[model samples]
Target chain A: MREAKKQPGIAEVAAAAGVSVTTVSHVLSGRRPVSAATRALVETVIKELGYRPNPSARGLRTQRSESIALIVPDLTNPFYTLVAAGLQDVLMESGYLLSITDAAQPGRALPEVVRHVLARRVDGIVLASYGATDDDIASIAETGTKLVRLGSRFRADFGDVVRADDVGGMHDVVDHLLARGYRRIGLVNGEYDAQPSQMRLEGYTRALREAGRTADPDLIHFGTFSRAGGAAGARRLFDSAHPPDAIVGGNDLIAVGVMDAARERGLAIPRDVAITGYDDIEAASLVTPALTTVHNPAREIGRTCARMLLDRLAGKYDDVAREVVLAHRLVIRESS
Target chain B: MREAKKQPGIAEVAAAAGVSVTTVSHVLSGRRPVSAATRALVETVIKELGYRPNPSARGLRTQRSESIALIVPDLTNPFYTLVAAGLQDVLMESGYLLSITDAAQPGRALPEVVRHVLARRVDGIVLASYGATDDDIASIAETGTKLVRLGSRFRADFGDVVRADDVGGMHDVVDHLLARGYRRIGLVNGEYDAQPSQMRLEGYTRALREAGRTADPDLIHFGTFSRAGGAAGARRLFDSAHPPDAIVGGNDLIAVGVMDAARERGLAIPRDVAITGYDDIEAASLVTPALTTVHNPAREIGRTCARMLLDRLAGKYDDVAREVVLAHRLVIRESS
Candidate 1:
């Protein structure tokens, strides 16, 4: 390997800027405010010298990597990526590097993916799990890594939990469909075993019960949380003799698929069958006859997750795991 | 900061697995062949003990973080995310953590973002740059950091360059449109100064020249690579007294916007005006009248980039910078 030329250190930066090392430290950490002019001069000199505070060297002294790792089920999903975007916003502000790993991609088992990240020994972790077990959660905590779960399946005590109101959002959307005078509301949800799916199903049932009607088992179909999955479920519902007058998709991608299926079957939206979705992804608004869905604040949830993790790392919170639930609301659009 | 408990080490794994320390090391690194039965036993013990080869500890001894950083313009765009997905597939196989940062989001200036990541002292950097300068590229090399540029603006000697065949891809698409006998063609391209835009424009001109027709400056529009931007550009082209019979969107997102604009103006796709897009993003096929565009193979580009970086780090290749250009093809779909 070619030997790298000597890297400029804090002393070099201080010398170049004609300031004491303490002044340069203050400028870097922002723990103590320096004069604006001095700060600018120090920054300019640092840039001109191409000097960087080696994180590894700093980590050795502080016992902190100054980095956080996020493990998501899939990076391709818009919802997860939006959540990541939100997490990055806050973490970067605090000078923490965010490393994201997709658990589902490249066919790594959820447990193995978790273990792999744990080995990295990051300062903290924000796990947006899809199929992790209780054992997996316990293993992370055992390592004493600052743990925050996004849409967690375990109880609040397991870790700092940050999730949108999946159940309430689903309930409101179903209620809206009921108020629209659609009695037979067929629901196509995601994997039946997933936490979000179960929560959303509970909301669907609650809405039906409030209307003095029990949810028909035949009207609910569980599948993957994808457009193709939504289309497949829609097909099964439409092919039935007792097909409903309206359909509710578990998420925006599913709703888009339902729309596609409706078009394929020569069904005019809201004329032949009304549709509603959840998550309120970007495509939800862009699609024709804009989808009526629930506004799940994915980005806010991400920001909240990062803040919770940072609080623990900063010693602002105790060992007691906390739970935070962000509000979700109905987004009534043309589809319904 | 609460103190974390000491973690299980390789010795713990070795004791539990009934193997020597070297045997466990070989299993983790895969530097030598081990019997399948012993490998499985060692892995199970490692998982059971929750033993992780702490990267910080290993990094201290080996002077390697076993991590790579990817910097992109935006994470929300499907194209970049797909690239990240591809990069992750290879990096994970080599036991390297991938840290991705969006340079555009949260409104961080590009140079600042670059500087911020450089301080982390990662093993390598896969910079999918949008607006980085020659100085920015040079700074990375000066630090002895293994640098790979995805879609680099500079020549190959600056760093390893991995990109798709933007020029040839555009040329093929334009030629296809010409063969269909579309006399008047307008091009809605990305930012005027971007390398991709320049290369694509070159292809468009080359095709027009081959057809014995000089390109018209009035028919070209430059805007952001977004659906809204495409719509605005389309409006200008449509409002013209002599609007072109065909339009080429800079990317799939732009094409989708053009389609929306056409619908609002009561123009039928391919009937009233033919439309083509580049990139062939997921929405390209999902959109109504599926977009006829170029398949840029974003994931392949990402995989190739990771491979190139890894090869350099492994010392399999010399310090000389290399360039790899993957092929692009026209995906003829319903829109055209």
Candidate 2:
């Protein structure tokens, strides 16, 4: 059995790190910023000292690894970053070590995520994949391992899913646009193979129909879920003879792309045309006109996902799969 | 001792996932966007099938775990995000699993990082901390583990070090400020204990001396490396009886904070007050009036750090500590 070497005091760690006992304590206490080198040194010393917290507690849960893996699509997205923060908070509270990875990285095959989970022999997995499939899900559930899916092609029977009401959120954005007197609204969407985009598109059409508005096929464009892709789609829409009075991008990055194209064409937002985005990331408020966007409640989703997984791992929800649907809100800002 | 389970064929995984062979293969190949649920389903099945990559290769490296861990301070910062990407790219090429963690999480004691490093038994570590010390570096060095320090306190003997020429970069920014005829220059810096801030302060003083300008005590402020902190620092400078016409922010986040305060005060950038930031993060270009800042070569630093660690692990540089100093560039944008 791989047992912890021995108990080591904090003073020893500090001395090993070559910092004062106070500095070591501060670094471990999360009270202040220790120099980077000092922080690293302390990390090494802790490992060297085999400083395991509470052996009795660890011994009781020797059956449990106290580790989980979270596979997200991309780290560049602030929305995902928020999810990571929220997830970490919950997991840390549960005394679980969270291992985060990206599904979008090259060679990051969906199977590799499984391979890692198995290799690490983690207790659970949370997948906020850009895209995953039915068969892929069945594989995870078949093992009886605790798992939760965040905003993907999930059916209730597939597994426990924690997602935002993107469909309703999009409807709210369209309604807000209509109420603001923008009739010809446009939607530049990406990730056609993903659930968020499909749901968003549904809401867009549903809202337009409810308002008794005519739908112009020309107003809709498709592109990748990125700034450049959004810009490309917007450029196409703007170049068309009849453009939209307002455009709601699939996400914030896409919306930023539209804003980029607008700037290039000298088109003023809310004057020549208005623009909105999904996922009210940190950058949304910092942009020139401050993009009006829908709050996807990523942090809540993360919390819900982590909580649900921990519950299952603890045998709290052993009888059936669990599900949670987080709410979304349309935030009215300068752009719209 | 534990050994990898028997290798499962792709066909078995497909059947277990309840997907067609073609779909399972496609999911693994990354040729198309497989739905998220399916991706999850497939991952579960792969694990259920006790999947292993290959036997001979796995056996050959059974004694040599190809896992490397990276400990960064904050995930909210885009600079660290880029570093993660760069490090992942190289580590992946070397057939090593890169495990990333943040050293700044609340209750994330310094020991926990080391504990994780030891638990995973990673072959090496890369520490991208804001601040670190000599003792810390020496301790990590004594472990006989390959280590690389990214952007922190350093000495010629502090293991292997990879850092930006922050002092020179700061000098360039100061010279730029002087060239724009701003006599009363201020600096709102964060992470007083970190190398970046100290180097930037040094650069500020050096440029002023070269330009025959005396440094004023009233023109300097210190705060945490955060936007709110930056804003607070800037508010102080602005409230001062003799406010500077120009100011330099320790990093982009700080600069943005300063810009926020200036905006609230109705001070037009480059008109009423010129502001600049360090670490030209992604948001620097997206923010209103863009930003003038130093381009901290984060990705290059990450690559360098990872490469050096891998080299050490492979016995490429067994005797002496290696060092690499990445260059920094000043990017002039509208904010300045």
Candidate 3:
């Protein structure tokens, strides 16, 4: 390791500027009145020295944490984490730092989690998790901070929302499968009550109905939104007397799981059990037979959420909650 | 969506608690002295109403952002994003919000970024980007903020560093390939100047020498740490007059690219050409032949970085810098 040079201290910055330390502190923090010439001098010295105004001392003057909290289910998924990256891209530039937390685990109610972050007096909270309860929504409403929701499909809605048109995306997936001459198509979906789950299920049934085929409730299996969930759903379909020739996973992770199960059965993908999925994650293309799936702009959703929160922070929209539904498309690959 | 109720205002809390609004604000921000009884009363009402004191108003009293910035190249890669998530996990519980910034794009100097974020008055910065320049190191040294460098491998390092054992891990990969009867093994490495690339190259050549095989300089390909670089390297290898039967990618994305290139050439993985990768990301298992690679604990690295920064913030060790080297394991899978 290279030896680190000692950085200039606040006292050195004050001394270089030919001002009292208090004057320099006040000039940096904007807590007290100071002459414009003196302020400029202090700032120039700070710049030359690369001095960082003591954050704690400045916080007393600003009365703001200048931080935002992003609550997601987890970061294990590339999709969720990428969204976070996107949000950071926007917020970091705006001088507002974003902190992320996982609320997907079974314990720790959403309200409690939000309360814990709010206790820090963060400037904003972006609720990007799934199935936020009514109480959770109410708790978030208690704070005046800007709030933006990702996948806001719950019946009791609050906050600016960035949602995906998964319904249309799923319809396209089913249509593509139908066009490929695959009959007995099955669906691997998330929880029944989740907003995305219901919308996707509706699209799946609607696609079958539009093709002059009756929807088969038996063909639809609900599980958690995870790889294990998809694997279990595929197993249920395969073990049944009437196994579907094609399966559409709610997300890429689930589709990967389904593919794993099929491989264990020595089944050739696309040749035997054609699989499709939503959320065209990076793995969707890397997998053996690249998964045929719907491409949801997850990062874009994150960016939109951050922008909406920033707009709220800026009062650009003035109490008018904006609902943004991002676009999606069907991505064809080797799997289908 | 259910209609949201009107949340109680600060004035309501003050009225209910029988305290003045200034007292309530002071109690929340800790800016001014408040009587113990009055502070407790104000707190109870604030809890009952679930009120979040306006961040800006509170900032005047506290004078701190209470946030940290994490500078990473990009989160599109699961490896980088997972590390950010790990840091968030540790920082959130300590009442500190973590902000993330991307330092990976070409042309934008790293020091400029560190300075820009420093101007935001963030409490600290956890820099997780690779290949920091001397200017970047010097710029970081100019700030009083606590800074932790992730993946820093330079012999002369400044600041706390968290690194993985990629060198030993690469040696194991070469040995594994040699044991499998692959004599002509090629290495698709990253930037020659970077620490991991140099270390991995050393391990690869050392393993061949120890196994009584002459190391071939012609078989080494240096490229960027990306999938495209790997694909290009693979093409060069195949087009060579003497092509190796096995290739070791510096990282997983590179290996994935190699697989892509091989497939385009009508080559069957493991049968025609075996490929290995480092950094056993989630994609490693999801790929066609499942990439055989080194398992670097990315999340653990993030956690350790965060812990080190927190310890510094708490002054636990009284100004001594700590260097943490994380362990890596060889994951044997179908690719080899």
Q: Which candidate number has the best DockQ?
A: 1
Candidate 3, residue B227: Cα displacement in angstroms equals 1.4
* Clashing residue pairs for model 1: none
Interface root-mean-square deviation of model 2 in angstroms is 9.2
lDDT of 3 by residue, A1-336 (tens): 333445566899988988889998788668899999999888888888767655444444655556788887766777887787778767767767667777754444466578778777666788876767877776667556667888766332476778999889899999999999999999999877777888898899999999999777778999977888999999998888888999999889989989988987888999998999889998898887889999988888888888878777776876667788889988999998
Evaluate residue A288 in candidate 1 and report its C-alpha lDDT on the 0 to 100 scale.
71
Question: How should the candidates be ordered by DockQ, best one leading?
Answer: 1, 3, 2
Q: Candidate 2 lDDT, tens digit per residue, B1-336? A: 012233466678888888987787677657888999999899888767666443223323343446677777777788887787788667765666676677677686555565556544456788887655555544455554567778765555566788899889999999998898888999999877877788889999999999988889888998888889889999999999999999899999999899999998999999989999999998999998899999998878888888888887777865577667789999999977
Show where candidate 3 strays beyond 4 Å.
Answer: A1-64, A105-109, A154-157, B1-66, B106-109, B154-157
DockQ of each: 0.46, 0.14, 0.35
lDDT winner among the candidates? 1
lDDT (C-alpha, whole model) for all candidates: 0.85, 0.78, 0.80
What are the per-residue Cα lDDT tens digits for candidate 2 across A1-336? 011233455667777777787787676667898888888888788777765343223322353446677777787787887787778767765666676677666686677666566455456888888577766666566655567888865565666788898899999999999998998899999877878889899999999999998678898987788899999999999988888888999999999999999999999998888999999988898898999999888877778888888887777865566667788988999998
Q: With candidate 1 superimposed using the best TM-score fit, by how many Å does residue B49's alpha carbon deviate from the native?
A: 5.2
2 against 3, candidate with superior DockQ: 3
TM-score: which candidate is best? 1
Number of the candidate with higher TM-score, 2 or 3: 3
lDDT string, candidate 3, B97-191, tens digits = 67666766443347657777777666577886666677776666555667788776634346777888777888999999999999999999887
